[model samples]
Target: MTQTSNISRRRRTKQAKGGADYEAKRAELLRIAAELFKEQGFQSTRLLDIAQAAGLDRATVYYYVGSKEELFHETVEGVLDANIAVAQQLIEDDSLRAIERLKKIFVSLMISYEDNYPATFVYIQEQMHQVAADETAWAQDIMKKTRQFDQILIGFIGDAIAQGDLRGDIPVRLVENALFGMLNWTHRWFVPGKGMTGQQVAESFWSIFIGGMVPARADA
Candidate 1:
């Protein structure tokens, strides 16, 4: 079965057993797991470590979070799904001009990364660039959703070019990849609650990159 189905089953099972308290504890465990994964790479982190950090025995940790992979999924998948959902909503919002939509997408995404705080960065560092084989259901699912997100950005850029909001000379995919590179590279240095907020970062990037993408003035 798919990762979604598997997760659903786990949720149902958890609910059947422990209801709201179970979910609350599981959420806390996932929080601890994300912090561990961020500090130490996934390969080095163990289920036992997460269990210990959560004040639970190994056996009970299994009852709450299952495996390390499941814990990883619990940490990452919600962020991915949320970003994708917001991007889709922005793309469908015809009320805004294409440039406005794209700007909102960039800003919103950066804020999301901030809000998620290291989960998105962990995913970028660990799995964003990997070729998703038929290895695991969650991996495949993440890859698929990631591509959909990419396409949405590309499509929006293409629309901007067609609408004369952006320069038509550059290839759409090139612009898309460049935008992603600019945003994704933040994983290397962006520290939450430090200098420049996510919106500031996004606005700075937009000014630098989108400035180049827009058509030059006739006076110039």
Candidate 2:
């Protein structure tokens, strides 16, 4: 290659690597900020704390995330994004029966909670406070994301009912709410080494949910 061409190629490579490095740093900052926000509450967590956690100066943290509230939003967005992706994948997979698919969804959700405990904790606490304080915008945003999950559950339940695998009399909304209550609350007491993997927990849930919700033969 000519000297000029080689220099240009090296410059392009350097820029590409720099872009990747920036993204990595941004993600690290968001993760650290999320942990701090979860532990201390978003309003109480200082930029300095996030900076210290991320091994960066406060100014650098601000440069990446802009502000504490923005960081919190980014953190929540990251978790929700992961959740949406998982739900989409579950909905798309056709190999499993509806009940089996439901089980996998629960398992994936529990694993997500376990993996992002800090963010989950922070989100829950913030949501409660938002509702209590009548922070309309925040509450609405939270509710919107919640409704997304509810809709996914409703669709699954609807499918199962159509397949004669679930009871049709139960309202989709009610079933969705009950299922979410059971699955989401596992983060409170679920311990990894306590003789139950996420799949095992999901199986137990399936026993109760499927047995109770499935239509009787006489009803068919």
Q: Which ten residues in a row have the lowest lDDT in candidate 2?
A: 127-136
Model 2 compared with the native: what TM-score? Answer: 0.75
Q: lDDT per residue, candidate 2, 1-220, as tens digits? A: 4754555565455546678677788778777877787678788888888888888886555445556777667667677778878888888888877766666777788777667766676777565446445556765776677678767867877887788787888887788778778876775677556777767777688788877886777656
Model 1 poorest ten-residue lDDT run: 127-136
Q: Which stretches of candidate 1 lie over 4 Å from their true place?
A: 1-12, 16-18
Distance from true location, Cα of 164 in model 2, Å: 0.8
Tens-place lDDT digits, model 1, residues 1-220: 5765666676668868887888899888878887888899877999999999988898677667668878778667888788888887887787988778888888888999998877677778985656365467778888888789888888888888888999988898898888767888898999889999999999999999976777988999
Question: Alpha-carbon error at 88 in model 2, in Å?
Answer: 2.6
Highest TM-score scorer = 1
- Cα-based lDDT for every prediction: 0.82, 0.72
lDDT measured at residue 137 in model 2 versus the true structure, 0 to 100? 79
- In model 1, state the lDDT of residue 14: 80
